[model samples]
Target: MTTYPGMPAAPKKSVLPTIAIACLVIGVLVTGFFVYRIVVTVPGTPQPIEAGMVHLEKEGLTIYASVPVLTPACEAQDASGNDVPLKGPTGSETITINDDTWYVVARSTQPVPAGDYSISCTDDETSATYAAGPKSSVVAFVLSILGAVFSFLIFVGLGATLLTVGAVRKRRGNRPTNTFPGPPGAPSNYSQQPPTTPQQSNTFPAPPPYNPGPNPDRPQDR
Candidate 1:
């Protein structure tokens, strides 16, 4: 149960892979949302009217009883059933669809004939304008899908990374490791001393007393 001082702790299984997986999921979701928003329309929303009838009053003036639909996702057509590009003086005019609403558009290139002009209205649910036009709703839709995909990918990546790191740590933990000698073991390569034999001291016999010359001198004196 003891942990080594320098050993790294096992990584928890709750990180990296989770983040990556989240990102991937978020990305896909955002993409799907974008697709959906581009398709459906809500009633009573400000939609464009095409081929709208215009009542001409003067040489240079044409008054459209109902303004042409110029918003993205809706298509505008002329009275002749031709696609009408929301342009000219009335192109950007804001006209309500109510019975009392009226829009004034003017043109200088051609003299207005004093007559009644009729235009038609049609809704194109698959118009490219919704996908690429400045007012297209696809941008928001796409972002939602992307966000979801990214989140999912992030989760996956974080989870995988955490799992891998934890597994490696566990493997190392179970392996036998070289241990440094501490209090329980002797130091490596310790040497022991061998016993030796005791040495004996030799004693020579005492030399005879040195009394020859001294005895002769004493005798002469006596």
Candidate 2:
């Protein structure tokens, strides 16, 4: 049988497309998990205010107050008595439900490295309650959710691009290739021809001159 001793055949398809699909799947799962972590615990348990002073920690510590407490009337300070920077809530829920009706009065969107903290607010009838919790802040929650989504999007985008590249590579890999040249004397375009063999001679040779009993009739000429 004929064979190509010098030709290299096309290789198998690429695995990049498969990798892209897996990446996309993983991205979605991760994004879902992160968002869930931030959302499932809305209005997270917080440190309650005691005697107008509440010790809080973390940057996103959200301050929650009773409906009657004016957000602007509240202030916060650290253990060193230095005023803790506070700003109006941005991109956070105005109200959350925990043990009672609480409104998000103020918060700091900037990463305020608020360590231990104290709160001072006028409780005219001492009927208002206050607390601080990072999870309670809607702004922080939304930002976290957005971060997760953006990460997912980036992964998906890369996956999609890789998948496209893989598809093209696979198509190229699957294409037929010619590794060896055609037979000798073949046209440049190439064409097959049946093999041939030498033909046998047909005519037979004449018998040698009558070799009858040479000495029978003629005397043995010395």
Candidate 3:
């Protein structure tokens, strides 16, 4: 097919919509996974303390420990057995499972270096110092959840923008190109037909009879 020199080529199909859809699907899947982790995977059975000492490690700024009952005080120590002052609880909550009660604890604002650590708690009722068992960090879990939420929002926003742009382009591509003549009263460049002249009627005068009278007077006797 011949293309005019200045005429625009047909618009190509947009890839933006496909990319947007892919992003949306991926974002939803990732968001769902993070939500599942926050809701179902984060909480775990509390480890019991033994012998006034528990060995553990820190993944973030703080470490957490849970106990069966309320304790008067708690503290942590480095692997070298140096006493580290326990930061105030970032979070503490009571949870019950199978008729047993547990206190979930989180550490303070200062981040602890990631490594082995020991936890010790003092019982208020018995004045006994006890060691806690290996446990997970609540602060790390909470941070993970927040990070996931932020990522999900970004993915959704990007996907929505791409989809909107693609849809607008597609609509423009589908619109019909106008090639018809202008309205009846509009002026045109073509030459106009000349006006017709009116036809005239034919008329003629009658001829006179031949005259031989002068010569007829002498020739009439013969």
lDDT of 3: 0.59
Q: Please report the candidate that would top TM-score against the real structure.
A: 2
**Candidate 1, 50-133: lDDT as tens digits:** 324444333222223243333322233334555434434524533333443433332223443344444333336433211101
CA lDDT, every model vs. true structure: 0.42, 0.67, 0.59
Off by over 4 Å in 1: 1-136, 178-222
- TM-score list, all predictions: 0.29, 0.50, 0.47
Instruction: Give the backbone clash total of model 3.
Output: 5
Task: Put down candidate 2 lDDT per residue, 1-222, tens digits, no spaces.
Answer: 354675565466678888899889988887887788677535556667676565444455567766645545667776788776777655434554555666676765455564777776555755767777663545567777787888799888889999999878877776766555667776444555689888999989987897655466567832
Q: How would you order the candidates by lDDT, starting with the best?
A: 2, 3, 1
Candidate 3: list runs displaced more than 4 Å: 1-46, 60-71, 90-101, 104-110, 113-118, 124-154, 157-161, 180-222
For model 3, the run of ten residues with the poorest summed lDDT = 127-136
For model 2, the local distance difference test gives: 0.67
